[model samples]
Target: MKKLLTLSAIAASFVAPAMAAEEVNVYSYRQPFLVEPMFNEFTKETGIKVNVKFAKKGLAEKLQQEGEYSPADVVLTTDISRLAELTDKDVVQAVDSEVINANVPAQYRDKENEWFALTLRTRNVYSSRDRVGKLGNDFDYIDLANAEYKGKICTRSGKHPYNVSLVSSMIAHHGEAETKEWLEGVKANLARKPQGNDRAQVKAISEGLCDLSLGNSYYLGKMVNDKEQKAWADAVYINFPNQNTTGTHVNVSGMAMAKYSPNKDNALKLMEFLTGDKAQQMYAEVNYEYPVKEGVKRSELVASWGDFKADKISLDEIAEYHGAAIKLLDEVKFDL
Candidate 1:
């Protein structure tokens, strides 16, 4: 009878594993396709399910409204500025995990450990293969504003978060006065008043509307996999800017632990797992993002773009200048 009771207790533990079996709630800016698979993998590994709330915008405000009673255990999104935004709002708590510290680099994580970068993507210049050709690879980001490239460039709205973050990095690297001049110059060089998404700019290049475009590297992967956009993807070659000076400008997709996590331990486990080998590999393969953790190979499609050294500037340093970046974009009337 003692033996039977012990077996029954063991089965009960399996069925009811305390908080470990409880679901972790995540409020994510990342789209479902990019994050759902990772959650599925995590559940399979630990039996701790992940439930996500997807939003294109306003999740930050929602978390703030919920306050300490927030069901959110995590915030998942791209860009260091968004990560910094969470820290500024006081909605995220510090994560003192040694596993995360070991897996994430000092440059890609918050100084206070409130957030950690999972992946990286470069802000590259894509030039038309038939028009700009091999010689375009020799240009720098600073060259985009030069008169030699006048009326030959296309770009998304400067107010867009992606461009705003890039401008922030420019401020970090070059300082206010020089960056201000550069922004005005880029605005002057626009062929169409900064009127589309990054992929739209690439499409413009392919359609002969522009010879060059400012865009992210992963879009090339997305476009290559897309039937209608494959022609646009095939029409260009990637250029890593600032290679002669600070290296290429890059940004991250990162996550933070919510301040009021109801499942702190399980959340920490999921966070650590994301920085580990398996999840890092999925980030590289599934998302076409460069893994923050060392030794993970990029997807074959990404690898074919050729390797380039990433800019070594601390992302937090760039994020510090985000407000100034937006202000300068307005000063130049960039989108207009």
Candidate 2:
């Protein structure tokens, strides 16, 4: 009886820790510097430890490979295509939260609640401060292709996800044929080959390599804050493209609950917290991203950039044209 009691106590010791341990696993494409503070705050508030596996790519494949045994409770990623890919691959599940629904606008979330955008960023045109003051109101995305601007613009590879999404938006606004033509024209305008990241293009403008470049709105803020890149940032005016027409193209960073989440309750709590004012505020201030939640104050620097109407096309609709966008880039030999 004594031996049996001892054995039972040993069993209980292992079981108790297993039951008492409260944690939620996360598979994230967002870098640690971007999300650690938010996760720490969440742990402080709820006592649920957040374990994250950060990766630049292949997170979707990892989740799929793990199947039902996957420990991932949530997924954090940027851009619509990745979110759409997760949905298409059936790795994430619908999260029907009143908090999330109230915090995010309908257009920023999946129609079926599979994913929700945490923040937004615009695809902006950065123009040389020395060469081009403020672009005219008529300066739309289509103007990038005008013969006058030929050999004056620079951009990253058209095959990149960011450019693909922009091309996708063009396809959404115009048809495939017109988007193809636009791609061809933009290719002709490249100051050199499409060869660098967004900031690289801005740096090129600073070096007088090009007068205009395609970049994200947040990159300007990032550059301005960095001592080295401040000059690059100051060298250009960030213009919201197509403001008078289709509005500037916007992209998002978002989160979703994994289909086989091991900690559903905690995962739900984390999701709600992220959409709340605190996390949303963090996103705005720390990353220079526009929060998805209404009334959340933007960073002073971001607000200083002034306001422009964002293209109201549904991201889902934009996502539908992704393949077509890629094909258009290839057909035009955009990177070549």
C-alpha TM-score for every candidate: 0.93, 0.97
Give the TM-score comparing model 2 with the true structure, all chains together.
0.97
lDDT of each: 0.90, 0.93
Clashing pairs in 1: none
The Cα error of candidate 2 at residue 178, in Å, is 0.7
Model 1 misplaced stretches (Cα beyond 4 Å): 1-21, 135-138
- Measured on C-alpha atoms, candidate 1 has an lDDT of 0.90
**lDDT of residue 107 for candidate 2:** 95
- Local accuracy of candidate 1 as per-residue lDDT tens digits, 1-336: 999999999998887776345688999999999978889999999988899999888777888999989999989987888899899989999999999999999999999999999999999999899988854335677888998778899999898888988899889888989999998898788888888788999999999999989899989999999999999999998888776678888899999999999989889999999999999999888888899998989999999988887889998899899999999999989999
lDDT of 2: 0.93
lDDT (Cα, tens digit) per residue for candidate 2, span 1-336: 999999999999999999999999999999898899999999999999999999988888998999999999999998888998899899999988998999999999999899999999999999999998779666899999999898999999898889999999999888999999988898888899999799999999999999999998888989999999999999999898787898999999999999999899999999999999999999999999999999999999999999989999999899899999998888988999
The candidate that achieves the highest TM-score relative to the unseen native structure:
2
Q: RMSD per prediction, one decimal? A: 3.8, 1.3
Residue 201 deviation, candidate 2, in Å?
A: 0.7
User: What TM-score does candidate 1 reach?
Assistant: 0.93
